[model samples]
Target: MTFTQLLRKENDDIFQAIFNHPFVDGIGKGNVPDKAIAHYIKADFEYLNAFMRIYGTAISKSAKREDIQFFNEQIRFVLNSEIHPHHNFCDHIGVGYEELQGYALPPTADHYMKHMMYHAHMGGLGETISALLPCPWTYWEIGQELMTKYEPSADHPFYQWISFYADESTGEITEEMRNRLDNIAEEASVEEQKHIKEAFRKSCQLELSFWEMAYTCEKWPGKEKVNS
Candidate 1:
């Protein structure tokens, strides 16, 4: 089987678990409000920013010397070319530097995010890979499904957002994560099967609600700023 096929097969159980989730459920053809979906995506960007920071840290430290150089080069490009330009999803939803600095969400949520960063920084890439598996895959599944089922209207803000993270470029990140996953599976002496599943589920739930909350806030005037 090809890498994509193999990945799908091995990760089938985990994907099936998410297949029943509300976030993925709503992405199907339905009467869902576009604003609601957009909000959730915006909230997700906040989480993404936090997540990127953590993953960026791990990628920095855990990479081999050559990989570290490559990692730095990639990051420099991401920061300079993508984020610095403010041309990605964050800008689409008004999540500028000011907003991100003052954005409020659960402290516990921050902790959930921080754990991955800490793992990467301390335990190296393997532990970090285990810590960081759930969100992107879940988001990719949702994006792929939504794009397949519903055409985004011209007014849809999330079209750009979804496409930005769901493109082939994201494959670069996935490849890195999978490489780390291989090392993790090989190295870990005692892995917790239940926690791995639970962490993914909890992260998905958090992600779904993140979208739900953002949609709720976006529908209200003078409420563009989201706080916990």
Candidate 2:
């Protein structure tokens, strides 16, 4: 199996919970609580900043021009166009965009972001991609599947979230990202391949925890790292 496929299959249960999580299902039905979803958007908004930095780390670590180009493309989208609407989503939830940056990092989020940065700093191109894959890839799959299965109403509260990831271009970008990871994986030794797969599985599990964290509306504990 390809590393992606292997990772997904090994963690099928987590993927199932994530894809079918109440937070996800709630989006389709517009049944999610305002405060809970708001907390999620805030956490995700904070997470994206770190995610963008990790992509930069990947670009610097990569020797391949195409890989660099791909990471750059993601970096541009995240900074320029990708997050504007999400900030608006935060506003709708009653948190100002600027205020979100000051909130303490929820435990799961801090742990997950640290996990990603470590791999980006310590791992090679393939390993960085493995560490990064589960978030976008899982969202891409869920976005496509949920919109189709549930066909959320036009006025669905989370319509934009459904529309963005479910869009055709999003799928193309996701496929391109996967191809880049696979290309790098082809150059790795067996031991390195094992490392890459482990990273993929760990990230996938983190993705599940992220969803759970959001669904439960876990607030920032008294002692934890602040979002940067």
Q: Where does model 1 exceed 4 Å of error?
A: 1-46, 69-101, 151-157, 192-205, 212-228
What overall lDDT goes with each candidate model? 0.52, 0.79
- Candidate 2: lDDT over CA atoms? 0.79
Tens-digit lDDT string for candidate 1 (164-215): 5456665566666566565555554545433443444455455544444543
- What is the TM-score of candidate 2? 0.89
Model 2, 109-164: lDDT tens digits are: 99999998888887787888888888888887888878998887767767787778
What C-alpha lDDT, on a 0 to 100 scale, does residue 78 get in candidate 2?
Answer: 80
RMSD of each: 6.1, 2.6
